[model samples]
Target: MFLLSFPSLIPLLRAGLDLDCAESWIEEKGRPLRDFLSEYSKAAVEQGKLRESDIDNALRNQYMTLMRLGYFDNIPRYASLNETDICTDEHRSLAHDGARQGIVLLKNDGNLLPLDPEKILAVAVHGPHARAPEKVMDGDYTGPPCRYVTPRQGISKHVKISHRANTTIYLGGINLHIEREGNDREDLLLPKNQTEEILHFAKASQNPIILVILSGGGIDVSFAHKHPKIGAILWAGYPGGEGGNAIADVIFGRYNPGGRLPLTWFKNKYIQQIPMTSMEFRPVPEKGYPGRTYKFYDGPEVLYPFGYGLSYTKFHYETSTDGTSVTLPATGGHCKGLSYKPSVATTPSCQAVDVAGHACTETVSFNISVINGGGRGGAHVVLVYTAPPPEVAQAPIKQVAAFRRVFVPATSTATVPFTLNVCKAFGIVERTAYTVVPSGVSKVLVENGDSSSSVSFPVKIDFSV
Candidate 1:
């Protein structure tokens, strides 16, 4: 069958007649896949599996798909294709803006960040990734970036401008192959040598320690979390070409970080408890499945929670709501929380129903006012979360329903309004059915950096299946 399907192997069939084949078949070249497919189509037609007209139709469809995708004469032709012209000043500015905005300030104890570049005599930058450029790319999928900026380069440039220094110290080397298609890390902690290097620097230097971490996934930085000397932490996820400059800008107060964490950063101890193979979205108490994500995770307090990020400056939030009740569509089933037990797996439960068989809903419209209290102008992301009442079933502890990024000038306020449909916000899914069971009051929280305001509204879930 292989010889018949692969035209290049037809010669092998003739060679097989000799029966004493000793050399490897790796040297054999295969015919073009298109030519092989054409021959295969002819054979299939003779065997009655496909009609002659079917082959023509398939080829025509493929040609049409290619044409639609601009693979033929429709290709674009620009006037200039020079690399420098392609990457314009506007493009560089946008890249810089992206890098600055995406920088998440994980920790800044005692307001140690937004470092005054002029205050220090000398600054020491050391990490396996601080000077390494290879850390930016993921395997062969991405070519070497046009411009590379290591964290060290970024920090040094700004430091040179601010402070004149004769000697700079670089310490410790921690290298690991963490990015690959099928490979996974054995653990989440930093390499032992890396930790030792940090400790060595901490003990030797009298100056403030600013730690910059580069990683695609979360790392357990419990040691740094407790360390008194380490004042700041910047989680710069593989910043692209302008990463170094962006890091420098944020450090020197050129940019204010508004990026929030997309996932939870677990501590070292929690790493072993939550196995990577566990896929349950809800907590499994019996087998010790802690569950995944901030939505269902009922484990130990994480190092950094989802949507948690620090900024150099602080902001305050004021929230007000417009409505009290909403109405929802009904499903024809019992309204209850869905549970997945190994022995007794069943469909999701249903909510209470009205005489008209429509679920009761409430629309909560919020007017959130965010004021940047600090001196620096920066952007703030307003996050809105909804918590279901106790009687409600199959709901997360709290879920983010709405979010917005607003830029508020120093001492100025930005009012961002959002309308949420309570019925849709609190809906849960069973095997194949979706139901909303809001029995009591639900809390709505509007949160900004360091501050949050919440309001409670009574819920009436009345629907008929």
Candidate 2:
């Protein structure tokens, strides 16, 4: 029953023979085996366990598999593949594009962003990440990049080209630490010295100040968030090889930012209340669990919401639904109430069939029109969220079902259409079965940047199984 060598045993298994044999046995029994296998296959077909053509088909497939493996081994040499040249113009341009899209404008008060290069008399770049190309290039994979552009270098190049400022200052902060496996920071606050250094530069600068943050994750920035002197704040998250050029592009109005926050930027104090390991989706006051994620957390500890981001150009959203409701057959068992628990021994099933024995499905579709209200052109990411009916069992406050990124010209509009399965979004998990009792109303919200519009439709669970 044991397979000492897989390849040697494959033929025996395919021929429907189960036996344990040694390598020496194979030498004695397998060499002149064409006549033996042919007779054995003929016997197997008469016994009805296998078709007469099965043996030939299996042997042909096995031969083809071996040939494919041999062919794949020479592909690298045949194609002349080489390591990526991170320093090439093409690579750097791609890096610039990536950095531009990754940069998020968290706070831009008084229309201070997209700095006018002509009006500025002086510029100051102050941060640990200002000139550290090595730190910025240390990405998650492939170690450090071969070449990189520092924030200082990027700013200098653009400033020189525009002749925008008479002077520039570099006020350094804490050096960035490359995060490796099993090494995570204890807190989200900037180093004490770094904070002090930033404050010192902000107070000493005579002209408008720009604070550019460079790190991989969110940090507490309540002070900078409210600071009046800090004209602009850009979150340049570990810009790779061409980060410097991309930062300069955004600073000098060459590129309008369209990136949104991928994670919530929580205040430092909230970390104490919500441990990273908490798995509860809803807050448990009795157990002191604050819950997790943007779907359930209701506290004011968040500095920025999940989808919050800023842009140089403004956008407006006009959303409308088809005003139609769908009814799907209700199958599977339902919990009596929120506190009801099903027995562990019970087998759960989710087959949707009506009394007439017909499978049922429902689809929901909507449209969102995004208008570039600002004079500048930029890309907008339209987010669509669905709020389940209040009567739905154990539903999140809202869930993002669909999103689309679109480029709209200055003073132009782009219409985006989305089709989604309503059952997938609104279904409730009871025991192990995912079921939908489509009753009451569900709300759909279309959002982009700070604008949002919503529509609601009622669902009827008329058919039962």
Residue pairs clashing in model 2 are none
Residue-wise C-alpha lDDT for candidate 2, range 64-183, written one tens digit per residue:
776787755677655565555435777667767988998888767777777666776346565667777465544555455547777778777755432234333332322245344334
State the lDDT at 170 in candidate 2. 33
Least well predicted 10-residue stretch by lDDT in candidate 2: 335-344
The lDDT of each candidate is 0.64, 0.63
Predicted structure with the largest lDDT when compared to the true one: 1
Clashes of each: 15, 0
- TM-score of candidate 2 relative to the true fold: 0.72
TM-score of 1: 0.75
Taking all chains together, each candidate's TM-score versus the true structure is 0.75, 0.72
* Cα-based RMSD of candidate 2: 11.8
